[model samples]
Target: MTHTIRNLSTLVELRSNEVEKLQSEVAAKESLRERHQKTLDKLTHLYESSGASGRLPMALALNCGDYKQGVMAMAAHQKVNLSMHEADMAVSQRALTAAYVKREVLGQVLEKHQHAAVTAQRSQERKQHDELATQLWYRGHK
Candidate 1:
């Protein structure tokens, strides 16, 4: 029985480690996604603030238009990349949640096994104590 408890504890520890690893992976993914979003925001801001004003000389306005077009294309690409990153992050999050649940279940099982082992030990001790008390009473009476 004690050996069984030991095996259970080992399993619980393994599950805990798995959960921690998955949590770190999810956090890393989340951080990457946030950075991509910031990049996209900056690109959009740049596209809007490009120097395409009516007061610009004709040649300069033409150059600004070309720059705007390039920025727009880059922004589109960035958005697609951001979408892919978000999808990956979502998958990682799901895996992390599942790991957390499995770890908790294992922990609960270990707790139950330990409690049963302790209870059994105390029961055995109580029986031995009761027998000793009865033997002393009988000896004294005789």
Candidate 2:
């Protein structure tokens, strides 16, 4: 397809839209990762603070121990989930970078096309003006 200023501008706009969508996707992934990390942190704190009292009666001691164990298991699971989210976020970030680069390149192409068009227009105008001046000079001389 011919790369006129209009066509190149359209391509640039399309690329820009794609970049924006990719950016939003990456941002959502990052936000999800942050929330997952926060949940993991909370799980860690819960695990750490769940220690059984030293002087509990037998039944209560056993119950406290069970609860602490459960907390540990949950924290372990949360850690794994956070790791998965991290991986997802990394993938999203790479995609965003690629899209951004594509958009920038398209924008540069559009800018170059616009500059060329303007230069051509000015050159054409100068030629016309020179021709008009020559016509006027010839008539005045006659």
Candidate 3:
């Protein structure tokens, strides 16, 4: 019985550790998600303000004033688009990482639970075996 109790305690400890690890992973992922979202927003805003479209009145005015200025604006817009694409890729990567972490944590917890169940079953079987042996021994003495 004492051994069984010890085994139960160990199982509880493992469960606690798993929970803590999962919580930490969740927090890290959430932080990464927020940072990625902020980066994406900044890139989108930059792209919008670059005036890539020739139809924009401001771009047309710049084209009238200086062909060089219109070209620069277009170049800036292209740079902004590239930045947006990079940010999008980063967001996708971060999201996938978070998902993988979540799955891994879940798997670990499940494994621990399975182990605990097996231990408990073994402990019960041992107790029953011991009880049966004692009963048989007492009957034989009588």
Per-candidate count of clashing residue pairs (backbone under 3 Å): 0, 0, 0
Off by over 4 Å in 1: 51-55
Best-first order by lDDT: 1, 2, 3
What TM-score should be assigned to candidate 1? 0.92
Q: Measured by TM-score, how close is model 3 to the native structure?
A: 0.45
lDDT agreement of model 1 with the native: 0.90
Tens digit per residue, CA lDDT, model 3, 46-117: 555665445669868665446545544665666665567567656756665665565566556656766887
TM-score of 2: 0.89
1-142 per-residue lDDT for model 2 (tens digits): 2358778888878888988898888888888888888888887888688765568998888888888888789888988988988888888788888888888998898888778888888999999999999999999999
Cα RMSD for predicted model 2: 1.9
User: For candidate 1, lDDT tens digit of each residue in 1-106?
Assistant: 8998899899889988998999888888888888999999999999998865567898888888888989999999999999999888888888888888988998
Q: After superposition, how far is residue 6 of candidate 1 from its true place, in Å?
A: 1.0
The segments of candidate 3 whose C-alpha lies over 4 angstroms from its true place after superposition are 1-79
Alpha carbon lDDT of each predicted model:
0.90, 0.84, 0.65
lDDT of 3: 0.65
**Per-residue lDDT of 83 in model 2:** 90
What lDDT does candidate 3 reach at residue 19?
56
